[model samples]
Structures are given as structure tokens and as C-alpha cells.
Target: MPIISLPVIWIILIDIIAWTFFHLLISVICLKLSSTFFLRESYWFKIFWWEKSGKLWQKLFRVKRWKGLILDGTIFLKKGYDKKGLHGTKISDLKTFAAETKRAELTHWLSILPAPLFFLWNPLWAGWAMILYALLFNLPIIVVQRYNRGRITTITSPNK
Candidate 1:
């Protein structure tokens, strides 16, 4: 049912190349945007009632135990804040980290948008595999971003 039905080897090569291209392109585009743009949590970044102010990730994903294992996007492009860990203790520093989390989350979310296009060359099952690949590659990072941002909010809030 694919539009092109490329051979399996070619399809695998193309999938690798395409994902690299899309991820880097999305990262570069996001880098060009002002960090200030991410300062405010948009609708998607808001902690859902079910998220329990992001503690859900700790309880379910044990984010603190392994989130540092995630690669820092700054290593790929030197233009943004380093997310390897908290770099400072000042309120301003925390705010900057929070903003960068939004940027990271948005980049990962955008990176997943092209999954369906793999169907042009891959079979039905492969295309769904691509979708799974996208989520598996990006969702944990997104979870870390949201979880860290929620923790940041707790620190920066006055009454909490």
C-alpha cells in the first residue's frame, strides 16, 4: 500500500537519514526562536490534573534516576542553554531552565510530526513502527522537560 515501496535496505537507510535531517532541522529552527518565547507555559506545557504537579513522572518514570542519561541537545548545537542539569541556583537561572524545557519539549514534539510520511516508502507495519520510533525517541525527553519545569515552578513560587 505504500506509494513508493522501496526495498527494505533502502527504506531503512532513508528512515535513518530522514530522522536525522528532521531532528537537526527542527532543532536549528527552534534555536532561532527567542528563549523568551518559551517563558510562559503554553496550553500543552501545562501540568494536567493527573500529573500531580509532575510528581507522576517521578513515581512512574523515575525521571530523577535516569533523566541525566538523556543527551543534552546543546552538544548538537551550541546555541542554546545546556540542559545536562541545573547550572545555577538563582531564581533567574531557574526561570531560564524552565524556558529551555519548553523549547526542548516543542522541538521533540515537532520532530515527531513527519512519522506518517515514512509510509510513502515503507509498508503499513513499518510506518506504524516509525510512529512508535518517534514516540519512543521523544516522549521520555518530553516527560523530563515537563517534570523539571513543574519542579522549577514549585521552587520559584512564593507561597508553595
Candidate 2:
């Protein structure tokens, strides 16, 4: 007999699917709540900011090219995706949209937090695989959010 049975494999698959669904669902909920409760300058967001992450992402991933592809391929970061269905042309609107993007990026990071807990129920390889999946899905978005927010901030700054 194999180390893991077919029924066990089915259970693992179900768990992975459920985990992905809950992760996305909770992320959306948090994103919605954050729009009302959090500000662009919120301390929680500031704490996570690493000047190095942005540099690393740019150097390692060439996020600008990926961002362009993503923007073209998906509704993400596109105009009219906002709740008000407005695009950020004006400085104030751009600032608001930047803040919203930061909130969303933070939510994605938070959503990944539970991945390691899968180890409690799953084999080591399976648990790590889920964690990798979570990171792969969210890291690019996080990098893009930071990159765009930086540009928006620079544009909106009084000194600019």
C-alpha cells in the first residue's frame, strides 16, 4: 500500500481548495472593511514597509514589466475597478486609490498567515507547498502595490 491512500489524497485536495477559498474570501472582506477603517498613513501599514522589499522586488523580479502585463491582462489596477467606478486622474483621487491599493496589499499578506498552520494537519511537503502557493499568488501583488503607491506619492507630494 502507498504511504497515503486515495481517500487521504482527496481529503488533502479538499482542504487545499477550502483553504484557498477562505483565504480569498477573508482577504476581500478585509479589503472592504479597510476602506472605511484604515487610512493611507495608518501605522499598521507603515510597520510592514521595508525600503528593501521594494528594491529587492524591482531588482529581482523586474516588477515594472510584470505590472504592465498584469494591468493589461487583468482588471487589477485598472480604471473603474474602484468601488465608485472612478479612475484616479486628479491628485486627491490618485492618493485615495493609492491608499486603497496599500490596504489590499496588506490584506493579501495577512491572508497568507494561516498557510503554515496547515502543517498541523498535513504532511510537511504538502504544508510547504500550500505556503509556497500563497506566497507566489500574493508577493507580486504586494510588490506592484508598493511600486504604484510610491509613484502616486511622488506625484502627489507638495514638493513635486
Candidate 3:
């Protein structure tokens, strides 16, 4: 019987241990920040749409990879331009939209680092974390969407 090299075994062991710890630590931190801090104040955020794109895709395609792609996609969209702006041709309307964008820009800054950090460390774990986070977060959104489904959404359309 041949004995394995100590360094090789040690390296493999370290990789597994590090990977597990990284997953756990990142999950806990994101959960705390997302659930307790940011989403706590706004049930809409906690329950409905924080990273919903992943789940949507997962449902659309039977493929497992869609899970991460959906989550990452939603995060990217949420961090993108505010959806409340009007597409008026006039300069004044554009200026007004620019001045008072409804979507929170600060959320982008807050959620930015955690996703990328986790992703860089391990895409697999990060994707898992994102999926879990999105599901947990969507509980509130579902309620809101249902509650307000037929209700008239007030849209302050800019006068062209």
C-alpha cells in the first residue's frame, strides 16, 4: 500500500474546509444585511423582488444553471436605471426625471460588493446563496403583488 503525500492531502482538506466556511460566512452576512437591515423596513423589498430574476428563469427553463443567471440578472436590473422615469421628448421632463429618480440608487451601492465578493470567492456557493436569498426575500413581494394586483397603480405620466 502506498501512502499519499501529506502536503497534497492537506491542500485538498484546506480547500474543502475553506470553501465550506466561505459559504457559511457569506450566507449569514448576506442574510443579516438583506433580511434584518435593508428589507426589514420595507416588506416590499423583503418579499417581492430582491433578485427575483433567478427564480423566474429557473421556472422558465428546466435547467439548473438558470437559477444563478436569474438572480444575477435581477440584481443587475435592480441596480440599473430607475423604472419610474418618463420618456418625454422635452428637455425639462428629462431633467425632472433625472433629478427625482424613484428607485433607490443607494441600494445598488449597498448590495454591490456582497454579490461580487461571494461570486469571486466561489460562483457555485454565491449562486446558491443568491437563490436562497431571493426566495426568502420574495415572500413579501408575493403578498404585495397579490394584494395590489387589480388596484389602480398611480402613474404620474409626464405631460409631453
Best by lDDT: 1
> Please, what are the lDDT tens digits per residue for candidate 2 over residues 32-122?
5745554547655542345453565677778767675553212442322342232758987776767776666776788788787666666
lDDT of 3 by residue, 1-160 (tens): 1122235456446445654565445433443343223222234332234334234323444334322222321243343323232557465444333322212322322333343333333346544565455445443333222222211111222321
* Per-model lDDT: 0.89, 0.63, 0.35
Q: Candidate 1 lDDT, tens digit per residue, 1-160?
A: 8999778899999999999999999999999998768887578777676887789999999999999899989987877889887879999899898889999999999999999999899999999999999999999999999899888888886757
TM-score on alpha carbons, each prediction: 0.93, 0.72, 0.27
Which scores higher on TM-score, 1 or 3? 1
Off by more than 4 A, model 3: 1-6, 34-60, 63-160
Q: What ranking emerges by TM-score with the best candidate at the front? A: 1, 2, 3
* lDDT score at residue 142, model 2, on the 0-100 scale: 74
Q: 2 or 3, which is superior by TM-score? A: 2
**Pairs clashing within candidate 2:** none
Among all windows of ten consecutive residues in candidate 1, which has the lowest summed lDDT? 40-49
